[model samples]
Target: MTAAAAMVRVEGLCKRFSVPRREAGLRAALRALVRREYRVVEAVRDLEFSLAPGERVGFLGPNGAGKTTTLKMLAGLIVPSAGRVEVAGFTPSDRRPEFLRRVSLVMGQKRQLSWDLPAIDNFEFNRVVYEIDPVHYKRRLEELTALLDVGEVMRRPVRQLSLGERMKCELVAALLHGPQVLFLDEPTIGLDVSMQLGIREFIRRYNAEHGATVILTSHYMEDVAALCPRILVIDGGRLRFDGSIEALRRQIRPLRRVSVRAAALPDDPTAMGRVVLREGGRLVLDVAPERVPEVVGALVALPEAQDLAVHDAPLEEVMRALFGREEAADLGGAIGHAR
Candidate 1:
């Protein structure tokens, strides 16, 4: 999409920080007391992308890959050292009142509600802070509470609510002003499977009803796989991949996965394809896309094979191969410490 048509635009984005350096000795520490040594770390490097209105995109990367830093920059929590970012036609770093009203940022680990007070109190507080019309706020709150199924918990103290309830309230508070853009960083973090699904559905419904552009970052692959059609992957503080999830699969991993349950094992499973796993009566194979039909046919013909299934490689495996786990591990340690 053209920049004008996009709700969010980032160009040549870069964020750098100068971190103090010190050795592991008392002498070095004493020397640093007088003068400190510093090194520049690039938290985000040359990021360029645009999100059209109502688009749901996943921002993915390993730990310390600049995912959170980029989200902070886009949400106006931090300024980029270099680059231009425009969200809903306003420069984020400017943090103008109008801009703030049009966008909301929700970090799962952060809480905006008062712990000692009821969640409804926090909701009312937000209405005043955002200057939301009382009538509009009431209608919006009712709608959000109903959709998130958090009405029963709204009157309870924030500290008394469970994590899932708290997260729902957090989302409700963030959306009270009716934002056109949302930055969600690990919104489902620390939630159970059912709770995660509830939040995911709420996000999907909110985006659909409001036509809000959403950018989500999560450690849960299921969240990304279910909600986002497009994905942007970053590594080592650089934009490594940006495209549809299907495109990412095709580019990084072209093989299809075939699983079969049988009463007896085939002495040489390699005849069908590369054996990925073998456990007693079950076998999993990685077969080329073109060879799937042939492999499935072969497996079905086997007297021992009872159930056979064909599928694509899991997103986790695809991502692991794409990022190279070893490289990500090394970068995580170095970049995490620097940041």
Candidate 2:
């Protein structure tokens, strides 16, 4: 069997920032000037991972967890304080034209297009920057316009476009060079549900058609569920989990949720499972995964049963539990434990 190639590789990767220490009073500030005070913050700590070609992976973390910092390292925006990192056969810190031409970074909070200029103008600018051929440029523009459903908004000034429209144009600009790898940070932030789903679908189709490798950091769990098959969750400047979504869910929330609609529930439903909810003739229970069949059996045998269904806990709930557990572990001084 042929060994698979990695699109990105990172080993012992670390980033540190020097933060100044300030005092409340003027006297303290004056004393600090004579002898400065500083604190070193470790943003990323000895992280090691690799991504195979065409893999769509979610990079998740809480605020200050270094999700964006790691992305910047991969995008060549910031150099790592320690360790080795490479993307598409190039060290991102080197920022070679050839290497840069093969990857693109789209930061939702940052704008690549000029605010007063039409969105199409930004595309033209990227074409020159990447030195794309005119034929290829037009073809890519047409394809992205169709996929993102932004053909009509392309000619409008960026300032005149809606937030959703501007986001679509940004995606187009990022892809104008036909990069094989994409780094997306908070891509769906601030968009309505309909627009978020639109962006999600477009990204899915683009990945399917082009076999591009995507590494995304999104606060929206729905986006992760819809687009990423695998997820790498980081917390407290370290990787907590790295695996398929199913595996992560199973590891953190092993219990299954079984809900039933009936005329009435048992007097003490906790005997069967912990009652999750009871309202309007519906009953929800959290049962051990191994006992789901037994619990559902008892519910099925009830004469008042109207309907029954069993499923894993919602991804958001699972993730919350995971983070809570991680926090507890950190407080307990078990920082080396892997999820």
Which candidate gets the maximum TM-score versus the true structure? Answer: 1
- Expressed as tens digits, the lDDT of each residue in 105-138 for candidate 1 is 8889999899999999999999999999989999
TM-score of each: 0.94, 0.92
Query: Which residue segments of model 1 deviate by more than 4 Å?
Result: 325-339
Highest lDDT against the true fold, candidate: 1
Whole-model Cα lDDT per candidate?
Answer: 0.89, 0.87
The CA lDDT at 324 in model 2 is 79
Candidate 2 residue pairs in clash (backbone atoms < 3 Å): none
Q: Taking the tens digit of each residue's C-alpha lDDT, what string does model 2 give over 206-279?
A: 89999999999999999998899888888777887777777777777888999999877777889888899988
lDDT of predicted model 2: 0.87
